[model samples]
Target: MVTAMASLPHIDNPVKLAVKDVAISYGGRTVLESVTFDVHEHEIFGIIGPANSGKTSFLKTLNRMDIFNPSMTFTGQITFNDRDIRKWRNVYSLRKRIGVVFPLPVGLPLTVYENVALAPRLSGVTGKADLDIIVERCLERAALWDEVKDRLDSLGSLLSGGQQQRLTIARALSQEPELLMLDEFSIAVDPVTTMRIEDVLKKLKKEMTIVLVTNLVQQARRLADRMALFLDGEVVEVGITEDLFAGQVKDQRTKDYLDGRFG
Candidate 1:
């Protein structure tokens, strides 16, 4: 059986994302507080928590998705590539560099080929040849190309739920994001498909930084070089994935959660 590296591939890599004393709120109620962590370049940084732990809310803050929700608020400092993301005047440009995949598959109503081509086209790739190359490369990266290569003309929505999820991944990769964030991407996926996507994520980390928010501790253990445990809107601990399971934790509750005694 294959196994993930016992430690980070590049432990000394510079920080790609830094969250300092961050807090997220909705309508004046804090959902996540005191979140401080640094995600290193080209590493899969996992966030694991139970429901209502503010994991999703924290992800929104990273990409500045709060702009879509007026009631949502963020405090503290978050830097991407050593630059304050809040200072960016162009949210579109920020989003282009940070791709996000939500819990559910959001396949566009367009054909499979078009769905993956849309981002490149919007980014000014007009040549059909260039688009074809991009579309194939992205789909292959997402592990969906071989299955749907012949069905590129089919509506993306017509694919199986797992296939659609992979399509969403392919679409995100088409942007060539420097940082990719996925929120519970496997919730709707089957075990087989989940494993396939996990393999894809393992390979993708070599190409980009990935922030993975998952409820499955085992999944995080398998993929993350390091991980943070979020409980009730607070980060309880952050450490190397293997070390955490080897009885390292700041709080007893974290140990319990990792042991499956509680979520």
Candidate 2:
């Protein structure tokens, strides 16, 4: 669905990420099954489910962090730009193209400037002028620049809870990812700030693919272009946001969940 690409204002805008028949297990117990999906360029995709569903586990697979857990095992192909993820020349390079923001504001111990500038510097952008420009641009995009610009030297942890979440988002944006994956990113923030983050995401999706794993059904209904319902390790259904919330979904389980009948 919606396979056209390279539209004006967005070239090289093909499918940025694809997960096909992907499954995962821990200690021989399966967690996900036959998961297949594509995150298109500049679209916001929402993955919604109850707590303990495999939302985070699925996001972890996109970045290949799932391979680190000793008990975890993954099967099937996760491709970026048509290249098999396992075959990616450098995992870090792939990760740089897909940034993640977690539910908690886990900012680094470093100052805000350093946190945002670290990856760009490591990627060979050594010029102070260039780094300064990048840091400012990403922070501004994440809606934290106006607040943090004058306090670039301040530690990120010192910011308020909402600001810290935005700081973490700014740090992810600093990498200039083609796709941004947010895992319940507003869970730890206030409602007002959550709305602010949602607004930022609405703007950001015009330039980057956004995959949001959230439990807030209303948020998904409001912000997503497409929505996927995850249940018991399977993608129960996926369709346009309007279709899913409009009671057109064909599956009983999905309808029940949407109606608050079950998780």
Best by lDDT: 1
Residue lDDT tens for model 1, 1-263: 01334334656898999999999889999899999999999999999999999998898888888999999999999999999989988888888999999999999999999999999998999999999999999999999999999999999999999999999999999999999999999999999999999999999998999999999999999998899999977999988888789887778888999999983
Give candidate 2's whole-model lDDT: 0.86
lDDT values of the candidates? 0.92, 0.86
Candidate 2: segments with Cα more than 4 A from true spot: 1-13
Q: By TM-score, how accurate is candidate 2?
A: 0.92
**Candidate 2 per-residue C-alpha lDDT over 1-263 given as tens digits, one digit per residue, 9 for 90 to 100:** 24422222232457878888988888999988888877778888899998877889988888889778989888999888789988987999989999899989888999999989988987899999999999999899888899989999999899998899998999899888888999999888999888988999999987789999999888998888778899988888977777667777867888888778883
Question: In model 1, which runs have C-alpha deviations exceeding 4 angstroms?
Answer: 1-7
Alpha carbon lDDT at 213, candidate 1: 96
Under the 3 Å rule for N, CA and C atoms, how many clashes does model 2 have?
0
Instruction: Return model 2's CA RMSD, one decimal.
Output: 3.2
